[model samples]
Target: MNINDFYTTRKNVFDKLQSSNTATKILMSLLMACFTGVMAQVVIPLPWTPVPITAQTFAVLAAGLILGKRYGALSQILYIVIGILFVPWFGEMTGGLDIVLGSTCGYFLGFIIASYFIGSITEKYAGSRKFKRAIAVIGVANFALIYIPGLAGLALWNYLTYGTMLSISSLLFMGLVPFIFGDIVKILGLGAVSKVFLPKE
Candidate 1:
């Protein structure tokens, strides 16, 4: 083939490849959001607390590990918008502004922040196949991010509406204690699964 013709053909092929990659990323983000919504349905209510145990933490961490910071956080944002506007995809199949502004609002906000941080950390170290321990440590740290906002939201909501202030110990008991073991499992699971899926530089 002529040199100019060869160059033109190569350019066209490269453009197509780039387009495909972009489409794949967009599809993955949407799918991850949907997966999170599905996870939200796997809820078990606690008698003493308003928050329920669900599969969302696992899905959130997995999304971060697989999609990196920007797209991972985007997926979570999409999930939150979907829950608020259309489907009852939040825990217990509940949704709407009421839920978003209710006692669990902090946890929802925490999800976005944690997803971004987790994805950022994984992309930085895990992407190069170095400092694998960073992934585990960051994953655990992100759990605290989720809990901090969650507990604060719970306490604030109760105090504003019921004139009852929950002590630090009470907040921890309701928001953190019951969930620690399960969240630890989720973090470790994310680390294990990241090894299988995260790309190496």
Candidate 2:
């Protein structure tokens, strides 16, 4: 088969995953929550920053792209709520109210907001295959939407924990700089498979 044929086949397969059914959407939210939970387990702690490198970021973005705004946000809500209620699927198999108010909660908020934002933007591309546009939006959502809240949460965590004032540059180096490459990799990977999750009118 030719390249176009391969692309079409792959597109069709993934496109089938998008559904308008309420039941299906509910199932998707649960499935994505589980997926994020599973991905959260792959944590690599950094010495400089408390934020670990987990594939959960990728999973979170994927859930938004695939499930669209409402269900996407719902998925993250389920993930957070269940984790807090004692699912123990959070990073390092830890969960509870402490995690909610902990240093990383901002990213959890980011995940929900980013998912909703991504899903909303992707909806605008319903019938079109605008690869560059999709990538750009994904980049914006991942970098801006996620990192803004994340940095705030991290800084708050540091202040609450250390009682020391830090500079903005210090916050970036600790919370943002280390994760730039990883998020870029995720953006490229998701952009490449844009046909799969990007909406089809």
Candidate 3:
């Protein structure tokens, strides 16, 4: 019930489906992208920070764990592209190249990286007996990937637009401090959900 076991189990499932279903895979990927957009709408704006608390990160984690690496990453990539070009599916239902080039852009890029990281790790560890714990760990790792870029992006945008360098303490306060507990809840929630839904091989 470690990474090797998980990889083998996933390989078996994929091998079974490899024969006649490229279309289903494509459809599912698109749906995951759409699902992320929908999740973005469930947002609560923070008074102090430009970033809001949204369900999008949970959706991103779910997509990666459920869809596997390639499709999971594709789903997020599609979500980002759609937001940048045509959809108001980002936080606060806002989008366009302006938003993409805005303060939160780092987090958007992080979503893609996080999705790939989560999906890849999940696929690698599919057969682990301690599935729930492993998923929780994976979720935490992915969150770090998301937040690092997010904080950096915020600082970068601020500097470029206003010529003011944000202090490390200020960045942590705006980007990481308020959300610590919430993100912990999300990691645990995803772990519990995975325990119920994923096969423990």
Candidate of highest lDDT:
2
lDDT of 2 by residue, 1-201 (tens): 987677676667556666457888888899999999999999889998888888898878877787888998999999999999969999989999898788887899999999898888776666523567666878888899988998899888888899986699998888888888988888878776675534344
In candidate 2 the C-alpha lDDT for residue 80 amounts to 96
Model 1: residue 24 alpha-carbon error in angstroms:
3.3
Error of 1 at 193 (Å): 0.3
Stretches of model 1 off by over 4 angstroms after superposition: 1-23, 127-135
TM-score of structure candidate 2: 0.88
State the lDDT of candidate 1 residue by residue for 152-199, as single tens digits. Answer: 899999898889999989888888888888887777677666554343
TM-score of each: 0.83, 0.88, 0.86
lDDT of 1: 0.77
- In model 2, pairs of residues that clash are 126-201
Report every candidate's CA lDDT: 0.77, 0.83, 0.79
Off by over 4 Å in 2: 1-19, 127-129, 196-201
Query: Candidate 1 — worst ten consecutive residues by lDDT sum?
Result: 126-135
Query: How many clashes show up per model?
Result: 0, 1, 4
The positional error of residue 97 in candidate 1, measured at the CA in angstroms, is 1.0
